[model samples]
Target chain A: MTLKKKQLIECQSLWKIFGQKAKTAMQAVKERNLTKEQVHNEFDCIVGVQNATFSVDEGEIFCIMGLSGSGKSTLIRHINRLIEPTSGEIFIDGENINNLNQTELREIRSSKIGMVFQNMALLPHKNVRENVAFALELRGIDKKSRDKVANETLETVELSGWGDRYPDELSGGMQQRVGLARAIAANPQILLMDEPFSALDPLIRRQLQDQFIELSQIMHKTTIFITHDLDEAIRIGQRIAIMKDGMLVQIGEPEDIVTDPVDDYVAKFVSGISNLHLVTAGKIMQSIAEYEASAGPVKEESLLKAKLDDDLDCLIDLSIKTDEPILIESESKIVGIVSKKTLLAGIQGHWNT
Target chain B: MADEVKFSILDPFSAIDIGIADWADGIKEWATNNREAIQPVKNYLNDVIIWMNDVLQALPPLITIACIAIISLQFAGKKVTGIVVICLVAIGFLDPRAWDLTMTTLSIVVTSVLISAIIGLPLGILAGKSDRFEQLIRPILDTMQTIPAFVYLVPVVMLVGIGNVSGVLVTIVFALPPLVRLTSLGIRQVNPSIVEAAKAFGASPSQILCKVELPLSAPSIMAGLNQTIMLALSMVVIASMIAVKGLGNEVLRAMGRLDAGKAIVGGAGIVLLAIVLDRITESFGLSKREKGVRHWWESGPIGLFYNQYKKLN
Candidate 1:
């Protein structure tokens, strides 16, 4: 969440079209009075992704949230060239990726980026291990080595010993966990998930979001997670980019986005959503000593409970070693204590800008 | 006290006529026409024919049927039992001379089917790839199929004369439509998503067809092949009147002499052949699903082949 802009994968003025004559029509726009919409109408090309741009930093869960056909999918696809950009550039680790050949692009895809499609797109034919091994297999890794890595990756997603099961055999959440394993197994520097949990039940989705957040915590893969639900974006994303009709309407941390939306589209999304889901380690995270902790250390206020998914009640009367230690009170006793500097430093990157 | 009407392929509609009266004129005209179309028809009836005379003549009735039995054993296994038994019984009851004529009819039908399949599959793929070609060929297949089975013989008899070659040729014309229609339909019905999946996996167009489209549509294509084989069988009897030997000739010869016993035996021979042909082609479709061979290219025999290919490459 504290990853910097230099670590960001950035998109600049991206446009994508769904038609054969896209290039020629875009050219016509360049030469004459034809506007983008005019050219689109004349040529029967849809401007699915239009002049969109955003940045997602390393370790930040950047979510692109929008309704179906709002170009959120098209824009996310631009990151990995599943759908190519009609115009503009995408830069990952300061390298522009639009001009790569098929081989070069596939290499980039195998190493630099991974994707979990909305449908999970688990090769219907392969069992869990094989699906997880797909990107590695594409990279020409031999079966034994890829299988070993796949098992380890499945463990990381809490799906150990499920390596032999088929995607259809697993529950939707488990299948998604397998899908997430497949994406993360390659250890791609950037992970792209297109509404991966949309197909799961609400209870399962919340569990998955928590699981994904915990997994990302350790792996630190720069994740671009797409979803339509504002609550999902606010809960899981460190920073969220709300998209509408092929444009990025706002890009900010979840709390900032909820409180100060840039447009009516984002405003409408934020209004009905529960603000509770937006509370994360980065928000509602106080400098432990700054709050009144006279009763003792109230470990419930600590970011570890929020970050690690450990029970808040487990931290009762828990002690911590810190310079300039301050007490945190739950009810009548000290639960935990930590240095104010350490608490605040975890939240440093966002407050300045 | 007889009803007289204008000469036509249609029926005379006499009060004495039954449902089969509709089929009567076409056969009568066909017989009259077959005698006139080729001078050799009369000669072949009384003398030896080359492919028919040599191939069917060299094999005794027992040996000829034993070959069909062996083929059924290899391809269809247990299902061949009833067919083999029925064939043996039918051959036992048939007048001995008619067996050679029936084998000739069987030979032509099998040969024409092979030719139709070879031609139809490629043309189907062509139609699948291009809508323009499909639109152009659609009506031709329609006309080729819809023109009555007996009516086609009149024209083919004119072109090549009433002989064994023309008989087989006419069978091809009648039976080919189903092959062409089914192949194109199967290929066209291949899943779009699967096609995209193959392309995304870097499969070339030919690879897509060989691996994805063709295997998935095998059932449909097999159905077409089955129907074509049936169509060829149906045409054999009509074709037999014109010096095409086999069961059709036996049936016609029996009808000429008014022998119901000979007619039933020949008809039974045709039925046995039809069952044998149907089972084999149906097995060809069933073979894919027989031993859990969905996506066969992934593993099993195909995977072994791929491994060998990789080594060679």
Candidate 2:
């Protein structure tokens, strides 16, 4: 998507170091990016996040994908001041949050930003209703009203009637749903989820992801999602950013990133994604009547389409004569056609040419 | 017939008396030799002795009932129970003469318990946080716990000489082991995952202690406190010997004159106090079972605790 909406949250040149001399070394940081070894040596610091800059527009599902220690969680945490950026400016809705006082920061935490952690991190001692209303309570909502909203939030997450149950009573997926409801119950402007579904089973993870997709459409809350799963970033994120070490290597729409990766790290991630069943007909369909005809008749739609598993041998279908424009049929008639050369080139991203 | 004339007379001294003197002499000799190695234990004993003497000399009678009742309500929450009320009322009935003496005895107990908590809590923290501290304290705690209540007095007498101070000292010495050790054990037993979670939540050290550590480990600490108080109570007669006033002296006096009724009533009263206090302490221990100190959703979550939660709501 284009940058059509107003930006809600932005980070510029963020840095974090973990030692007594962090202040001194941070003073010496001149360039935009610092090497891990240099950071470690200068201050005996563990560089948690480095020079990270990104702006999440209102209502956008922005994802930061990285492996463990890629600093994605730390970077996201900077938004809420959960882990204060060592030396950077985080602006929420055009206001620089670096100087927000304790009370102001707490207000922001309760009313503006909500988060979901990897372990679900639900207060185990409380039941679903209590947990759902927990942050709301922190913000000072009355019991009757908070309970009403908590129940509604629970219903939104498809967890209605489960509110009376405690965290221990729910399964991993259910607990995460509770976490989701908790985050959204306060009706915050932005939601930050750091691998919230990482602990659930695969089936449950997919289910929750789908729910998020539905909810994001209806809820329309700006969300920053963090995950290591590339496909997840593709399926759920409108725009996905890939990170390695502590730097953003690439960021783009899911298909654009998958079909045309920025570098080897992203390419490696793209190649392993097998959920090709989700690719639309519009993405792969082509016109095949442009080339020379062969002996046998092949459908235009068939010639234009090739599965990810299909090789060049698939062009040997009798529907088309040798050396003719490749063709394939759809419901009733021949559709667009293409030659093997053109098809291969398109798969190789020659469409731009 | 001439030799039998003297033998027929009753022997003046009993064999049991001879054995008691030998045991006392042996302990004194051993204590002198091992005094240096046992300096910490000795210091602890001295502190207990001094504090107990002060309390035994100062505490009043009616206040003892109030202490028991207050503690009982907090602990068991069964305020208005007949037995508890009866126990409270009985203190008032202890013939007007017994009133001041009862409180004198009580003042020593309550104060020593307060001191025990102050001292034992830190020691328990040390023991809980460090394996080496625990190892170092194990034998000493074991000795304190295992030694008879009466035995504490002998050591108290040796160190501070006979008086209320020595009596109170012996009570504290015998009672503190449980509280210190259990507090350590309970804190150590709290779930590490929860502690880590609290840290991730931006909880400061003080907040973690007040919110997570103490609330979670309350049961064990209360258990320790309860044990300590009961042990302090047991030291009464032994304490009375050191001039600490209380029912112990009444029992001892009655015994001297073979006054069976006074002895029975005094002993029964002490037993009643023990039951009342023990129930109250166990009630306080129930705090551990209270919902996780986190907010509940209904009345604007009870925030991290009762106070902040109230403010938030």
Candidate 3:
């Protein structure tokens, strides 16, 4: 966990305004500090992304979470240059992608990045295998090798025999699997998934999420996932960035966001999320000295013990069996203590110092 | 002041006439003077029409009927094939001259459709991709579509001279708009996300057009082709007034002689041909899903041979 990974994707002060007057609107925003609403009212331009900045580490699942129209989708599109930014710099693996020519951009896209859409968008005319192999076809790969790859990728997504079937013949969940298969078939280094499972039923969505997490673990492809659901972001993202009105409000780990929301906007989103598994013992624990001073010295043998990284759910389970406070250890030394009261506070979105 | 205003209103405002008619006449004069430049094109078109007509005429009537039946069976299935065969037989029985007239008309219709598709498809695709191009062509297409076929017939006869070639030229003018409009519409109507998805995967603009947009818009394009073929059929009859030989000429001659029987026979042949062509082309546009699980070689003459071969084995 302490291993240092290189940053693979970075965005610096990205801005995207829509409409014919976008250039003037962007200038107004920079010069006179116009708000999103003011820009829309004055210039008839809709702000898509507003000076957003973030980066993803290599092999990290970085999730951008926001409601519809918050520009999370727009922000993701900028990574692939699908929707060009009005102004900003994007670095992929230390290369400033904004400077890349169209051919270079396409070269990078074909070899390095893969994207899955919310709608699947699988070609109706193509059979599932052909659809999966389409990216390879674009790269001018031979039919035999690409089909081989497509079949293998399909098998990985548990769609072994469905390759010959057209997209419409498959169920919604199956179609989503085909979409995922298509993205990974080219063996791209980066994956951009835009709410890929949002259209499915809850049961199928969770199933696909689990499969995706398992796939990502084995592949270790750097990913930037976009979703409107906070729970989804919390579940899948190593780090979550929350956006509102085309601006990123806060970016942090799921535990950090849930336990310490930056403002009411994010607080409202996380308030409904169950953080039993997200709030760690290290986050809510008090100093071992402070705990001893308050309730006298505790015998470590009588109380259950947990590591610093153990979640509140674990602490709660440990606290149920024993009335004594649990000891939080890191590197084999007692660092902090979590009692039932502290566990309750952690569950209620409060952190004990 | 009131008297001056009344005089201004009554003045008729005839100061400027744009002189579009004079401009048109100037173009006609230029084309006539430069007729040699277009002679090769005219000769090539005439040869192709005559060649196609000869090929059709050389085939035995029974062979032609069988070919149509097999094709209909392959595309539109047994029911449509049956109706088409019955209609063809009926036309042939009603007028002994119907067969030859139908063949000539078919050749002309096919050639005109081929030329329209060749010209209209690229123009439509270009218009589809660029708003400015589409805007520029919109009024031209509207004018082409709205003007009566007879109006252009005069200009076309003057430029190309009266023959099957002029007939083709006029038919192209009449039929090209629908295909172009539909092709443009088809490209434009493709889902934006689908195009975006293709782009995200590193598809070039042309790659996106060929692999995604074109395939998705195929039904629309086919619909356009259907419309174009129908328009060409209608226009070919009108083109016969310029001495183009076909079922239309038969009807025209019969009309001059006041022979209702001959006219009805020609009309019947045209209708029968239209129905068969419409149904077959329509079948091509039907998605595989809608057409069910039938394989291409499983229902036509090929299928019959395959089944027999299987049984023999």
Candidate 4:
């Protein structure tokens, strides 16, 4: 799905080192290959982001996951230019955002992009409707029109009657929905959500995540979502990028990251997540020729069939229905086979053919 | 012999004098020479004080008391309204002269608070927005707050001479600092995330100040105004030394004649006025949610008439 759409946002070699000597530290990082700690010790600078590069296609939800201080939040702020990059280039819809003047940058922020914060930073003084209509008010839209749009957006978030209530009067989950409504009310093409659901209880978090996923699908907003939870990333992300100490360790599909992590850091994060739904048959299946050579030729009529993209749980169900190994097909041709042993191994985090 | 007996190797450093007193004298001369340039300001202040005093004195005491009761009922509820009404009646009964004197005092307090707000709010906002401006004003505010009112009173008398205008000027100098400091503090204390959200939504600096920061920090600003009003009341009494007339002058005259009964009456009147003003201004700081939700026409004297109209219809 991502292959066909145009790239809506792109970051190239982004670096953000926080300190007075950031320029010197950036120079040292470039010329002498200084590490994060080395730069801090030598130049009194903390590397906020280092050499980060990625792009989000239109209507894609790209999740950047990491522990705290891993620069995921810092990285997301660059998209809206809330925190200017120490050294790098950012392009939004093929325009170099760094080159925009203050007015032009604000124009894009108000009209082209919207952000949802983790803290649900709704203005406490304004009622929910006014808070949701804030961006429109900033654009000098009349109160009558902005309020109407705000009410409609409130309905979208299932907060129809909550327009008159102050933010402090709402529950954590409802406040977050208000935050989400505030962002989408502006109807910006791009959405930058920084841990929007991270502050809620487990039940509310899951509920909001589900609602957000549904909303994203309907809205078709190109999103850059930041989270520390790998489960959330696997649940919502079309592609996940794992960050560590201001660097992107690996970026790939959820299944790829789960089945084949680039390094131990990513492997550690993936270990905690269940692979039942993330691991696909194509990742664990053996070639049909190799499978036939090992055993005898497989009978097509007796075999249970599964798509190549089918997850481990589906393949397991197919294997249970029939005593034969599951046939993995791409289009009409059988590309691979997933037997019970391979399915069990796949669940155990093994991808041996 | 005393000089020879000095065992110290060094003498006190007295090679030159900085002549701060001389510079002050020069400034005094400049001020005296420029009094004509400042006559219009003094005249304007005198006219405003006289006009406000006339307006307050012209209203019947019962009408004034009723207005206060209605205002207190609207903002502070029934208990405060009762206390305020009782206090006003007590002052009037204690001394019939207290009523007219209280009006004079109220006029000065109101005018001073208004002028302080006008000067302090913008300066405070400027300090809030820029660290350099805050730094520049911090020492000035500290001097205004910490320096004795008596110290500045001399220059004030020299410049504006002795009258209600100088009294108002001195009261402003004394009352202005807290409002400025509290306003700056309030702006600084606003949640940073809220500010960031405003920025993210592409709010201009001025828009952010007006739409978000100002509204959120209103409670603190009101607190500042309360402080300013209280300070202005206290300073207006001290300003009586400069021949400023009012309830303060009554107290001063009683002290000179050693008339203890008269002093008690004047002191009681000032205290009553202070309590009433404090309660009224302090109520302004309470958030609307805490004050309970009510439409504008549903409280005060307006509410009384509205209910009557509703019943009639």
Best by DockQ: 4
DockQ-better candidate, 3 vs 4: 4
Off by over 4 Å in 1: A1-10, A19-45, A55-61, A79-84, A90-115, A120-191, A203-223, A277-353, B1-107, B148-169, B238-244, B252-261, B283-313
Cα lDDT tens digits, model 3, A252-339, are: 9998899889999999999999999988888989997888898898788776789999988888888889877889999999888988
Whole-structure CA lDDT of model 2: 0.73
Candidate 1 docking class: incorrect
Residue-level error in angstroms, candidate 1, position B33: 25
Q: For residues A251-278, what per-residue lDDT tens digits would candidate 1 score against the true structure?
A: 8888778756787878788878644334
Highest TM-score, which number? 4
| Model 1: per-residue Cα lDDT over B12-128, one tens digit each | 443334657567556656656665566554355324335544776687766766666655554455456456757665655666655665566666777778778988889988887
Query: Residue by residue across A117-188, what tens digits does model 4's lDDT show?
Result: 999999988889999999999999999999999999999999999898989899999999999899999999
Which residue runs does candidate 2 get wrong by more than 4 Å? A1-3, A28-34, A275-353, B1-214, B220-224, B227-242, B247-313
lDDT of candidate 3 over B1-313, digit per residue (tens): 3434332445645544578889888877776777777789999999999999999999998899899988988878888888889978876787777898899999999999999999999999999999999999999999889888887777677778889999999889889999999999999999988888888889999999999999888888999999999998887668899998989998898899999988888888888889888888887777656777435565567888978988899
Candidate 2: Cα lDDT at A321: 55
Between candidates 2 and 4, name the one with more favorable DockQ: 4
lDDT over C-alpha atoms for residue B91 of model 3:
68
* Predicted candidate 2 versus true structure: per-residue lDDT over A215-261, tens digit per residue: 99998889999999887887889899898887888888787677678
Per-residue error at B233 for model 3, in Å? 1.5
Among all windows of 10 consecutive residues in model 3 chain A, the one with the lowest summed lDDT is: A344-353
Q: Estimate each model's TM-score.
A: 0.65, 0.63, 0.93, 0.94
Model 2 interface CAPRI class:
incorrect
How close is chain A of candidate 3 to the true chain A, as a TM-score? 0.95
Docking class of 3: medium
